[model samples]
Target: MNTKKQTGIHTGLPKLLLIALSLLTFTVIMTACANTKSAFPDSEGKIKITATIGMITDVVKQVGGDHVSVVGLMKAGVDPHLYKASQGDISKLDHADIIFYNGLHLEGKMVEILEQMAKKKPVAAVSANIDHSLLRAGDEKMGTEYDPHIWFDVRNWMKATEAIRDVLIEHDPDHAEDYKNNAEAYLKQLEQLHQEITEKIASIPESSRVLVTAHDAFGYFGDAYGIKVMGLQGISTASEAGTKDVTSLRDFLVESKVKAVFIESSVPRKAIDAVIQGAKEKGHELKIGGELFSDAMGEDGTTEGTYIGMVRHNVDTIVHALK
Candidate 1:
């Protein structure tokens, strides 16, 4: 997770023994070698690339550095689930040197367009989906598919970063080294983030490792950590939380005596509150834990506004609430 300091965009670094020291030295020396900008326009001075959303856009900026000018189609606070491409989006994609989307059918309605664009351009799904074995199937209530919210877990996102870097290197051979170095640097940071998150989550009591949400988006997070996840909605926001599912969840909350249920930043708390309400009906009272950054990051200009910041915020909130 490449943590953003403030303004949701400020972006990280580190090493082994001698190899690590040399890499750090090299990074300090090469700090001024590239720019994280767009990668189009043919003119060495200007390049234009488009990203599907803010998350992918930030990632491109982190890895592409100043070598490319990037455009993000989805505005902050916009739901990617039902986003429709405007004329401007097509134009941006048409002229982009490369494009990145959070695949695994995340952009469900937009997949056809993206595939067509991929035929004539370099495009990637950029999810841990490529590694099918690691993915768990979404429950029948959430539709018959695997959950696409792999980025919810920082460790899973590192795989997507590698995929992004590999594709960028292939398309823009000139900046292969730069892309590789940036991705490597970011990957190390993500590793550290994973450890940090693990330690934080570990600080919570083992009996408190229960994460309930509006949807099943936290499957990967729960999988990575030792938490039992219960969701009122399906894996996708498109699916509504059904009566049976809610009843089952209510039963689980009462049986497990779960302490907290979390609400996603992008989702309404009404649904989660219902779960808590049901628990109270059964003589079990559950806390709201805290608001978490789930499908999307926090409000723009905040620490949790960036991808890394969002994850760190989640880790901190979860640890604090559960512990």
Candidate 2:
């Protein structure tokens, strides 16, 4: 496979794992059901919602609460832009009442599949509620018709939360009030998060307020915090940081005396190290600030495993590094 093809192919591993887990869970439940006919009363069926990635799945669970069971199609550390659904995923989708995805092209190769599924069932683009003006122009980057990483900004993510609530209400109208209340609560939390991040970023010295990363995943974040951000690649995971992008960033870092550059949890670090090495060649050394949760959240069973925790950890890391 070609370089881009290889990247795309590997991205499906997470989805495959999720699909497998869902199938396993389903099988276990079915076996239990077969053994006991009257073990539990089955009068009402719960709504099943599936998301393309963990972050979206997290929000859906928060909003849907006990009325819905949410599944994240992508596993931790997987890139949603390159994920492909497996046969197991098809089975999971076949049974889902409603599905949610981070649209605006974040689900790369899976976009078309999701679209086809939408025609047959209820599948809403959670990111559709995001204002177009707020979206970053991904025109300059390859395969990025428009940047789809709005979730980077807590405020922008409120839009996603609202969209999720709307979709849930549409499908499960009996629990409309519940979804609204949950969405409101989540939105309040997100607003508080936005304020906290602004304060934390503001604590950094003005001269040192630069966010450099493996991919252009922080445009929304940079816009929110007044920090100058640069990414080696475009919004699309398919775009690699070529020699030219690295050379330019290195020159800028050395000239500006940038203290630290960050690597992302999901993206490879080779490109970031190359930037640091390039700066070193120019007689300046830049430290690795910290790993940021860019396209994916941290591993399970960690504080950074949740959306709130991930944002807090990133803020803490950046403030400590740049301040």
Candidate 3:
């Protein structure tokens, strides 16, 4: 799940390794030869972009059209909470014309490296302009940072899409017209998708609107579509689900008669399985609703590969299970 962070859990690299990575980033910044931004307007080739997650990569590709070539560091089912960039990913960041990522501590372990690179290049977080009031506040255990699952809220993602379009226009002014046209078309599609999701969710019986999943990744989704969401784990998979947590959730399902529980593609299924067993012991026959794309989108070339596709899949899956 490339859209979250955690504390007191798996930091991708040990403390010593992170220090070395910081030093290496500084050295790369100092020695970097190309200033992609200065040369961007005149460059005949596609703008080379390195994005941290597939969602951002898709945005860049869509807005930049034929003008940009983008690569995402995190792939399908790769949890960004635990992702550590390799030497190759560092090289990609160093060589890119511009870099984009989800901020709000989503890519926790890569923070230092990204900051080091931003000193020399155009590195932007797509959620840079989201109002603080719009974000879901985190609890003390997760610190005071806002939740990073902004994409689950279609409105926030539309803002992010516009941000990507504007950045591409600013950096590659020659393609401003194309970028503008592409963004307008894409934003319209997103508007339609948002409406579709809203109406579809409204069809589910109000009493069956609870969505149980492996983690709290769908908090934004739940808020946006009027669903009551419960997770076995906290916001980040870095924390483990204890017996007490499972028992409590199980008791809720039994009491509420919740129809189904979902498994996340990026999270482990063991916790979900335990919850199901607990529910069964209490006489609730909860079905596994469907595997939802929470932290990571589906694989490339599939319907779930695109951001729109992923959202549609989640909503449709939820509607089927709950209805």
* RMSD for each of the candidates: 17.8, 13.6, 14.0
Off by over 4 Å in 1: 1-46, 128-130, 139-144
Rate residue 214 of model 2 by lDDT. 89
Candidates arranged by TM-score, highest first:
3, 2, 1
lDDT per model vs. reference: 0.76, 0.83, 0.87
Task: List candidate 3 stretches off by more than 4 Å.
Answer: 1-44
- Candidate 1, residue 189: CA error in Å? 0.6
> Using Cα atoms with residue i matched to residue i, what is each candidate's TM-score against the true structure?
0.81, 0.85, 0.86
| Candidate 2 error regions (>4 Å) | 1-44
Candidate 2, pairs of clashing residues: none
- lDDT per residue for candidate 2 within 5-52, as digits (tens), equals 989979988999999999999999997554332321231367866677
Clashes of each: 14, 0, 2
Specify the poorest-scoring 10-residue window by lDDT in model 2: 35-44
Q: Which lDDT value does model 1 have at 129?
A: 38
What is the C-alpha local distance difference test score of candidate 3? 0.87
Worst 10 residues of 3 by lDDT: 33-42
Top candidate, metric TM-score: 3
